[model samples]
Target: MSGFVAGGPPPSGQTSPDGHINTSPFWPSIDLDALRGTLRLDNSISPPRLETAVIAAAISVNRELAAWRIEQQAAGYSKLEEVPGETVKGVPEQVHLYRRAIEAATGAEVCERYRSYDTTNSGGKKADDIAPNIDDYRRDLRWAIRDFLGTTRTTVELI
Candidate 1:
């Protein structure tokens, strides 16, 4: 895939191809296929373990994206400034797409877990929330994998 192209006129000191104003800087190329392949592998292995892995992976990727966006905003990118009465940044759209796919893939199991935890916590009781506990989430994820694969394996080493 192509690298990120910063939208707008080029930097002040740069010259354009026509020896006029620089149009824009060509950003480094991003290998979207590689990224998708990595993420897809995180999804495809051990169908039973899919829910936990997918959710955890989604959260991890989302956090990284958010941090990157923050860095870009700090660097005076179009993250804050409006362009023609409209927002210029596209991070939110990307995040929404990721979130929707993840939810669609694991919605049933996650919803059940969510309701269980939610109801338990509603009685003025302190129950551990499943969504925020990565270790427990991973353990449960492993269990799901084991169940789906029909094995009592405890460790899955992905190389």
Candidate 2:
């Protein structure tokens, strides 16, 4: 058998075990395992790449929400999780939105990186297939951020 089998699990130690990636003081930490499972990310994604993508996403999300966060803090809400939102199974909805935003952003980042990772014909075809996904991922990220900010996703302005 060849060294690499299609659909086979990646060799061990390619990714980290279940763990947490700490966020800023005002944000909830992200669970690495949850992110991987929720996004259906396979072992093909290396740990370093996954971590880098996630950190980049979090930084982007945090920067995008910085103004709102400051306002919330001035209003006596010091943490993103403390913002008023419906709870699911005792977990705040804002937390879900935040994670969703990160996941979507990470997906986009991964897709973008993958597109440039290979130049072979198969790789090109795969990149083409995923081209639309990048947009969708970005859209989802925007919606999630909007939801977290309690803003409407669309703003239809008359021309």
Candidate 3:
């Protein structure tokens, strides 16, 4: 108990005993299998190369989703699920979404829908001047996170 830190994320690959932060990455995780099913690699690229990319992508996505899981935990929704394993079970629903996100990432880097900050161009158009077209996978994740937060975003007008 002395090593435990309160009000923060759980340790990697395991959840808190009280189910506080169950957002840790799955233990004994092998993203390669999932990646194999999702992707069709050419003979040119070796298995290890593909495996490394998938693992890295999964880890990245997992870390990012942890914040959302933590947020849900804070809001009293303790069921922010993840893939199940021996002696472990979490949000099964979210697993596919996360996997697809990883697959999409590995296939081709998802670019920002809109450009970053930039000045006006000679033709009067500018980068990031318009709305972005987020991919379905990303949009779904965003929606899920927003839903897990258990509140709809509302705008307020001040007069």
Best by lDDT: 2
Model 1 bad stretches (over 4 Å): 1-62, 78-109, 112-159
TM-score for each candidate, following the candidate numbering = 0.21, 0.86, 0.41
**Model 3 — which ten-residue stretch has the worst lDDT?**
1-10
Summarize candidate 3's per-residue lDDT along 1-159 as a digit string, tens digits.
011112333234332223211224342244443444444433323344555455555666667667776665677665534323222154354554555556555443222311332344722342222223234444544554444344463548899
The list of candidate 3 runs beyond 4 A from truth reads 1-28, 72-91, 109-159
Backbone clash pairs for candidate 2 read: none
Worst 10-residue lDDT window for candidate 2 reads 1-10
lDDT per residue as tens, model 2, 1-159: 011123434466765565667777888888777787666666777778889999999999999988888898899997877888799988899888889999999889988887877799988987888888888899999999999888999999899
* TM-score, candidate number 1: 0.21
Q: Please give me the total number of clashing residue pairs in predicted model 1.
A: 0
- Decide which is better by lDDT, 2 or 3: 2
Which residue window of length 10 is worst by lDDT in model 1?
A: 20-29
Ranked by lDDT, the better of candidates 1 and 2 is 2
